[model samples]
Target: MFAALPAGASGSFGLHPQDGPHVDVRIAITDDQVTLSLTMNLVFLDELIPQRREQADLIDPPESSQTIAALLEYFASEQPLLVDGEIVEPRIEALYIDDPSPELMPLFPRTGMRGLRKIRFELIYPLSSPPDRVQFTWNSYPMSELTGGPLVIKAELTAEGILDIVEFTEQERGYTWHRTGQDIQSRMLQVPEPVVQQEDSSLLSTISIIVMAVGAIVLIAMLVSGRPAEALATLILMVILVPLFYLVGRPGNTPPTKEEARTIFDSLHANVYRSFDYVDESDIYDALSLSVDDELLEQMYATIFRGLIMQEEGGAVSRVTRLTPLNFDLENVGMLSRPTGPGLPEREALGFNVLYTWQVEGTVTHWGHSHSRTNNYTARYGVIATEQGWRISQMQPLEQDRVDDDPEFTLDEDIEL
Candidate 1:
C-alpha cells in the first residue's frame, strides 16, 4: 500500500504484509552513547512465546531467558552499529509489552485480527565523540524464517533531528551516515567498484612490470647461449623500456578545470535526486558533501529529510525519475591562496557557479495507491575549490513548477491486502 509517512513504527507496517509481524527500530544518539528502541509484533512473537498453564506462569515473563538472549543476539548481529569501523556492543536496558490503540490499528495490517502486542526494548551502546562514520545493516530475520514471511523493518533516529527516518525491506539491507562539520569531515566512501575500474587505470603498470621481468629473463638467456649480439640488442631495448615504463607508471593529476567543475556539479545534482528516488537518506548526505559545502549539506538535509517526515508518516514514498539539467554555467572566481599543508605555500583557489534548469518526475504513494507529477526545477549552485576539489558552496532554488497535475488515486476503506 502506498502510505505516506516517515517509516515510523505505525506507517511502516502499513506498507508490508498484515498477516505477519514486523520489527520497528528507533535509534537516538547522544554524545557518548546510542539508544535503540525496538518494537516487535506480538502476533509474530506467538511462536517465540513459551506455552504456559498455571496462573503464576501467566504472571511470569512471557519470554524465557534463552529466548531473550537469542533475540538480543539476533538484533545485535543483524544491524551492527559501527563507529568508524569498530562495532559497538549494546547493553539491554529495558523491555515491556503493550497493545496498540484501536485508532492506530488501522495503520497496521492484522493488528486487530488476533489482537496485537507491542514488545518494546531499550538498548544502549557507547560511542566515540563525533564518530567518523556511523553504519548499520538492516536484516529483520537473519537467523530463522518465521510463519508469516520475511520480517519488515522500519527505522528512525530521534537524535534531535539529526537523522532521517529509514525503512528496510528484504531487498534493501544497509545504511551509512557520514559525519560532517564540527571538525568532523569525511571523504567519500571507497569509490564504487564500477567507477573505480573505469578511472585512474593501473593496467599500464601491470603490463610494464610483466614486460620488464620477461625482458630480463630473455637477456640472461641470450648472454648464457653466447649470443652477445642478441644480448646487447636486448640490453638496448631494456634501457629504452626503462624511460617508457617510468613515464607510463607516473600518476597523472588532472587539475580542476571549468569543464570538470560543471561535470562535478551535474553529477552531484543527479546524485541528490537519485538518493531520494531510492529512499536513501544516508546516500543523500554523502553525495551532498561531494559537491556542496557543510552548511549547504545541512540545509539540504533539513529540506530533503526533515521536510519529508510528515509525508512519510502517511506511508508515502517518493521516487524521482528523469532529472534533466537543461542549462548550466561554470563561472570562475579570482584565485585565492590557501595553505596546502605544513610548510607548504598557498595555492590559487578555483571558484565557480553551476546554474541549471532541472526537469524531474516525482512519484509519491500511500496505502498501495500512487500519485505522479512532473516538475520543472530551476536552480543556481555556487561551487568553490577545496582541498578535495570543487564543492558547492551554496544552492538557490529559483523556481519549481508542476508540469502536470497529480494523477488521482482513490483509497477504498476495504482495500485488498
Candidate 2:
C-alpha cells in the first residue's frame, strides 16, 4: 500500500506520506503481559527496498539520523489507554490467533525496551484514527526516511485508515516506497556490498581508513598486549598528526547478478624521505608491518610506499602533500574532534601516539529476501594520532557490540529499510 504525498513532493522515493499512516502494529498472546517487539525501519530518500546494484551506499552512521531513544519515547505515548479517543487499539493477541496478515505488526516495538528511552503505559483505553482527531498527538503520521535527519510532518489519519502525511514546511517534498511480504524481503537481501563497513570516507579512502584505523586500534591492543614503548611513542606523534590517516570511498551500492565482489581502497603513496630528515629502518618496519611484502622488500621498488609507513623514524622528506593522509589529531586538531571519534592529549609529550575508541549504537537494514528488515549494531572504532604532525597511526579495536534484536511482539514484518 502506498502512502500519499502532497501534489508534488518526495521525502522518500515514491511511497506517499499518507500511506502506512500509523505503523504496522502487531499485538500477540505470547504470555499474560503485553509484548512489544519492533520499531519502524528508517532509511534515506533514495534507500527504499528492492534496491538494485547501482543504488547508493548507505552513508553516515545509523544513529546519523537521530538517537534511537527519542524514537521509542514517542511510540510509548501513543498507546490506546494513554490517550483519549474512540478508535479501538486492536487487541493483537486476538487478531494473531484469529487471523494474520502484513497489516498487524507495530512499526515500533517495545520489548526489552530501554527504560531510558521509553515511557511507561499507565493505563489502557481506545484510540480513534485521524478523522476523530487523535486526542493528544501532533505527529499526524510517520514516513520511513529522513534527509540530514528527518523532516517535521503534518498529517491526519482517519479511522478508516486513510492518511495524508505531509511535511510541515514551506518547501514540502518527500516520497515513500511501499510493498509487502516476500517481494521486498528478497530484494533487500540481494542489495548492499557484502563487506562489513568501517567509518571515514569513500572508496579510495576506505582502504586507507581501514588500514590506519585497524593499525591504530591494534597499537592500543598492543599496549594492552604489552608493547609499552611502541604504543607510547606511537601515541605521542599521532596526537600531533605528524603523519595523517587516509580516507577512501565505498564500493558498489546494491546487489549484482552472478559475480564476485570487487572493492578498491585508497592509500598513502608518498615518498617519506622528503618530509623528515631522519632515517630509521627498524622503526619504519614496525609501523608498516601490514604493507610489507618481505620478498619484495629485498628489491628497491617498494621504497616510497615503505618509507611513508611511519610516525617513529623513516627516511627524511622535503614535501608535505606527498599523499593526502587522514588527519591523526587525536587531541583537538583539524576541527574534526567529535565526541564519537577517538583522541587523547595527555601523552603527546613523549612522541608516542595513543589510540582512542568511539562507541556507537545505530540501526542497519539488510535487504532480506521476501522481507526487508532493520537491525541494530553497537560498534566501537579505534583511532590513533602522533605528536610530530598528527599523522594517523591506525584504526583498530573494530568490534560490533552484541544486543538482542527482538521486541516482545514483533511478527517479522514491521522493520523498515
Candidate 3:
C-alpha cells in the first residue's frame, strides 16, 4: 500500500506550533573516524526531497538508488566538515525511514498522522589520525514558510572525553572544536567576573573632619580670651588625638564567625550544583568559575558532572532540583596559600575548612517519563577569600548514599484527566 501526502495542503504544509518537527544531531569522534547521526520527522525529509512525498509506505519504504544518491549529494554540498583547515568528504553509512515509538506518536502533528514518520541518516567521515581541530557547518535548516520561524537543531557532541549539547539556530550554524593541552575547547561563553565591593571608609573621614572643626573653634576662642599657652597645648593634643581616633575606627581583617562561615558555605555549595543547570559545557564552566577557583574549575566540573550521571539508567545526566543542608561543622580557619606556577611565590589568603552533609534531589527525564533520585552526601570543602570574594579551593568527598528512588510516567499534555 502506498502512502500519499496529506490532501488540501497548498504551497506549503503547516503544522501546529507545538507539533512542529524536531531535529537532533549527534556527532561522535574517535581516533580514526567521526560519525554523524541526524534524526528528524518525515515532514522535514519530504520538504528536503519532495519526490519522497509519493513514496510507498514510510515503514521500510522502497526508495530508488537515484533518490539516495540525490540525498547524499545534497548533504555533500550543504553540510561540510573541515578538519585541520581542510574539507573532508563524508561517506554515507545508512539512510532509512521508520515509524516512531507508539509512545511518541501522539507528539507528532495530527494534520499529517497518516503519512508522517521518522527519518534518520548516519554518515562517517574518515581521518588519518586524531584531529587537532574540527569544524562543522550546518546549512540544511528548512526555510519553508510553513515553519512558524527558523527551526532549532539540538546537537550533541562527544569528543576527547567531553560531552556537550549546543543549539544551532538560523543565525548561528557553525561549531568549532579545538584541542588545547589534552583538553578540548569548544565554544565557551565568557562570563564576567563578579566585582567585590570594598569596606566603607567615609565614617572615619567624617570623624576626622568633625574633630578638626571643633578644635579650630576652641583654639580661636582661647586666643581671643588671652589664654594663648592653653590654646597651643590644645592644638598639639588635637593633632595627636585626631590621628589616634582615625586609626581606631579603621576596619581590620577579622576572621569570619562560625555563623558567617556557615552562610558562605551554603551559597558556594548551592552554586556548585547550580552550574550544571546549563547544557553548554562552556556555560557550565563559566557558571562554576564564579564559585570555584581557576585551579580547581576543570576538575570540579568533571567530578560533579560524572556524579550526576545515572549509570544504570543508560548514562543519563540527572538534573538537580533541590538541595537541603543536613549538617555543617566548621573544621578549621587559617591562612591558605593559593597555588601558583613554579618559581612564583605563594600568596597567603584567609581560608576555612568545613565538613558538610547535604541531600540532593535529582530527576532524569527520558521517553516521556521522569525518574527521581534523592542522595545524601558528606564532604569537606576548603573555601578561601580571593579578589573575587570567597571561592571553593578544594573538596574531598567522604561518603555518598542514595536515599530514595522513584519512577513516574509523565502524562502527555494533550491527555486530560
Candidate No. with top lDDT: 3
TM-scores of the candidates are 0.42, 0.16, 0.46
Q: Tell me the tens digit of each residue's lDDT in model 2 across 295-319.
A: 2222322533332232221221211
- The lDDT values for all models are 0.55, 0.27, 0.67
lDDT of 1 by residue, 1-417 (tens): 011122134333343334355555677766688787765555544433433423311112644354456656765776678878888987777665443344545644534532243455677888768565777776544222333545545465544234445556678777776654421123232211111112334776677788889999999999999999999999899889877877756653343556666566666665555444323466556666665566567776665553233343353444553555656666554443432456776455445565667566555433212346566667776655665655556677788666664344221121010
Q: Model 3, range 1-417, lDDT digits (tens) per residue?
A: 222233333112222223544455778877798888865555565555656435432533455455567667766777778889988888777765554334434654452543335555677899998898988887656643345676656576777554555556778889888765342112222222323334457876787788999999999999999999999998999989988885766554456778888777777777788677666788778778878898889889988888798876667788776777878899998787776568988787777899988777777643112457888789888888887778889888899988774233221121000
Error of 3 at 346 (Å): 32
The regions of model 1 sitting more than 4 angstroms off are: 1-19, 26-36, 48-91, 103-116, 123-149, 152-186, 189-258, 267-310, 314-351, 357-376, 384-394, 400-417
lDDT of predicted model 2: 0.27
Q: Pick by TM-score: which candidate is best?
A: 3
Best of the two (1, 3) by lDDT: 3
CA shift at 126, candidate 2, in angstroms? 46
- As for candidate 3, its clashing pairs are none
